[model samples]
Target chain A: MLDEIDRQLLQSYQRDFPLVHDPFGEIGRCLGIEEDEVITRYQRLKDDGYISRIGPLLNHTKVGVSTLAAISVPAAMIDSTAGMINSYEEVNHNYLREHHYNFWFVVAAKDNERVDAVIQEIERKSGTDALVLPMVKSFYIDLGFKLWQSTQAD
Target chain B: MVTDQDIIRIMQAGLPLCPEPYASIAASLELDEAELLRRIDAMLRQGTIRRIGLVPNHYRIGYRYNAMTVWALDEDRIDAVGELFGAQASVSHCYKRPSYPPGWPYNLFAMVHGRGLDEINDKIAALKKLIGDDCRQSDVLFSEKILKKTGIRLKNRSSEHA
Candidate 1:
């Protein structure tokens, strides 16, 4: 269960994390707590699956190139096919989203050539054509999500 | 010559929760602390680092439903309409991508997340109403399982440091 301070810690620091010598101490000062308390709460949150990370989100564009790709697979083959796709280090995310194209995943690599190579390799092995949809433009900088209102003692 | 890669490689595993986080990282990189901070700030200015902050697991935080809605919008109005869709509070990631015709006809992609079924449905309906008739066709994709994410196949076992 999250206390008021835990909720505040999660909600307030989604962006613009402190960049000082003692970041946890800095956060503690902001929330009227101590450095050790802030660190302990963040650690607890991670252990309990409340957060994934607490640091820099790099722009993938600056890092590499990537694409959104999908393949429609038979019900029986979904598991095997997903596993096969996941075997490649270039593939970053694989999700079984619904549709005729029921399996969607992303292929990210250091360059366009490598990204395309991975897609082709997947197609060759899977025997199903991939629907590649690369981004043309982005509309917003996702500053991070605002906390939804808690309904119960969670 | 402490490059961005050197700094990021150490920091990307998720900042160490210590009293002196950045200083510790800089020390590991064998570079001056001020130089590291300056480089990071410079990257932020150049849009290399989007944000330096917390990434919550929305599912754990009560946002149980995540719906990806795709709209087949006119080419000319995609810019204006995409902005409007992105500005919605529930929408997290929004992008304009090419649509393969005959079957797939969506150019604008937006994700809407909610706590439950009723709330998610209401949010989708509201988005359609917001877009009005410009939405020629639309579809929603609910993921059954996350086959793989980052480097972990999450039954929540692996140390997911994304």
Candidate 2:
């Protein structure tokens, strides 16, 4: 577990990783640590699954289009169905929601029609019907957690 | 450990191109290359920075379809249902959001994205079969516009305007 110093460092960086040339060096100066140490610790965190990904945050709407799609699958065949859906590279993330349509997942395709084609392919393969509800409006929330505020319990 | 100035410079300029970009950035700040490297490493270790890489552009690659799928689940079996739904690859952002009246029985929410409406429909059909008749209702909320797109800054910047 991270101590106070470690916690402070995490809180600082959780917002956004620097995009500078020598970000490590710059951050190190602030935190008073060696660049290699930061690199090593981050590597360890990622290896341990604490960090999900280290990549760009691209805009979805700007490119072409993207939608949030969902499907309901039988309990027995959920495993098989999910495996089939996951096979597509376009489908990046998936989830199992708690409801009658228990099995819901997302599919990022090249276009609206392409999204439909992939859904059709899933239907043909999984034999499950999906209700395609696209997003008309969306809300944004600052999901960032404040360690200082949250740490009051401790 | 990095100074606030370093972060400001990066956020202002955004991610740079070319190899050994950090070295160039260090030169501009009048900091040693070794020092810059060390600070970045420390910051990442401490969680001051999550990562240093390219964030993907989902729309550019042709993932146009997006929708919010809500499902009606039996209260007693929600745990089991959640496990099942969590296993799917298509569901990126999944959660149990609060429900409202007007016969809004569906309490489970999942995000589904694809190329178009048809692809999402097909998946929904398959999902219906897999989930059995346990779900009494389901609905999809399609996205119609692109509202806002940007990264979240960690610094405590004023947002009185927002």
Candidate 3:
């Protein structure tokens, strides 16, 4: 469903964006399109849920602390527990996965105290002990992939 | 003077979608565009901001399957394994964390993306080929459903941010 330009924009713009007064203009220049078209396409992409946002992916350790906490919630309480955890603004990414620790979510905040507090609160309130696995070291992998690599390879 | 924290607070929400996005951000903070751009550049230099660009949701972009592939590897071999798998094109996020044995025993998390289970299986087989013997056990945890999802929310200085 994606056109060539849409595919290019999605593939190429994952990182190293131009920092300028008119960044969209700069992007337009690179892709041989007008600034307005770039903006409109990006906006449509966001609306269509193809792209989330255009911004900096923060280095969590440098700015704020975060933890990948998982809780083994029984099926009966899955909905209630997810709702409660989602209520917290700090819990941005929550997923229902297939495992004993079925309820997995990320808690990110300005400090470790806030991170711990949220986890503790979840454990106490839900009566489900959480496995708090704070990131020790992040091994770097390049973000984004060649969405059309197979076709392009030929 | 606009501080780095202030910039962080503003940018946590996301870059604006307009012709002159940075200028608009600077105007909101009542700071000049040059100064704001300087701080952003500084953050990029210092490795605080990983990247500044458009991020696509994997599923929407035809990557319908993503596995938070976790491995319980021997402590001595974890570092080697982490570096090896981290370089793979299929793996997006690879990290080393403490493994709680008995219930959870996954210390290395390699978040892999694939078009479907076939592609994922290929990548997994490749990974297994490379990380032989070092890995004690592994499990693939797929996201059955998203209970809640927000792109990224950066907390302000004990205040609020999107």
Please report, as a value between 0 and 1, the fraction of native contacts recovered by candidate 1. Answer: 0.85
TM-score of 1: 0.92
lDDT to native, each model: 0.83, 0.56, 0.85
Question: Which candidate tops TM-score?
Answer: 1
TM for chain B in all models?
0.89, 0.69, 0.87
Best by lDDT: 3
Expressed as tens digits, the lDDT of each residue in B72-133 for candidate 3 is 99888889999998898878889999988867888999987888889988888888889888
Which whole-number lDDT from 0 to 100 does residue B92 have in model 3?
84
Model 1 stretches astray by more than 4 angstroms: A149-154, B151-162
Candidate order by decreasing DockQ: 3, 1, 2
